[model samples]
Target: MSTLNLLRCAPHALKKQPVWVAPSRNIALSSFLRDAPAATASTKVLPGHEYYPGKEEYGTVIGNREIVGHGEIPYYSDSFMVPCPAIRFKEVDEELGKLREKEKGDWKLLTLEEKKTLYRASFNSTLEEVRAPSGDWKRCLGDNAILIGIMFFGLSVIGLSDPEFEPITVTNEWVDAQTEYLIKRRVQPVDGISSWYDYENNKFKPTWSIFTTKETSQSVKTLSERGV
Candidate 1:
């Protein structure tokens, strides 16, 4: 039979003890919990599913490629990404069982309530219900706006109390010192400043580093002292 038909009819047979042909403990547990149920009066758990108290109710059972449910919570979501839920939201009780039998006939013949009843038995919510706005984003945006206001207020207080910031490295003295250091180290001499030097003028006439005679003499003296 098709998986859908099995899903529709399997619950009626779920009360019966499953044929325990599974090889491993893991398989046995999922299959037993999914396939069979405990006696209601005694609250008896099936053999393999009862690892501890109420462990059988953890999730649905799986056996013979069919899942049966017990004491599972109902849930429904309208999502485009996830197409299938692991199990039905509602279990098939006697009323739903009878309706399911009738569901085998022409769906068009079924009354609106009957059709709705059948659908509700399997799911807790519809696409329209899930898609409806809950006004949650308003609260979220309000909270974020309050946080932004607080951040701005704190930043204003800090800026008013704190001393003004200065970037010392951007001053003329610092730049001149850095330029002299670079000249002393003969930075990029082959492909740079020296490559376009006015040797006859005994001066650095390159466009970028217009070094005066005094600064150039100090850099050259530093380079000679450093043996480079």
Candidate 2:
């Protein structure tokens, strides 16, 4: 393969960019991949899209059947819009535990920096609590053993999802740039025209230049050139 093609085929092998964009929001691969097979047709992972029943449906089924219309309701239709896979929480947790144990030994060997860049857990913890404490578990280093262990657990699950992509080393510059981009708001107009002006007539027309400052111009140029 050509160099470009080879790189495209193995993008994760490239040198780290200055930012990381998580592929999915909140959904961990382990929650799906580690799950046990469905016990019934309702629970199966269907090929097309799926729907989750809203509170009203769930409440009607579990709370008051009388509130719903009088009829023999179908099992799947009554409780949820999607297939109600017959998996129990206990079974799912047990399966996840087994999967975690299978990978924990090796995941523990990865460096702290690698864990953060690779999207692995920074320590060990339940997935629900993985994002607690302001999602700043990395800051707990040397102080919070519980959070660190949870981060460790997250790493193993992420590692199991992709075998080839090792986490890249993160830099402070990368983190700063990513944060700035993440928090940037849509553009807005400045309220006033405050500029040093040269007099043409009695009128103080502004300078022809659009750039307000050297720093601002330089930053714009850097971002445009790098596509970061």
Per-model RMSD to reference: 12.1, 27.8
lDDT tens digits, residues 49-115, model 1?
A: 3423234453353211213333233233334332233345566677777887787677678898987
Worst 10 residues of 1 by lDDT: 62-71
Per-model clash counts, in order, read 1, 17
lDDT of each: 0.52, 0.36
lDDT string for model 2 (43-118, tens) is 4322111122333445444332111111223122212122121111122245344543443457667566544433
Measured with C-alpha atoms, the lDDT of residue 28 in candidate 1 is 62
Any idea what lDDT model 1 has? 0.52
How big is the positional error of residue 213 in model 2, measured in Å on the Cα after superposition? 17
Instruction: Give me the runs in candidate 2 sitting further than 4 Å from their true place.
Output: 1-144, 163-228
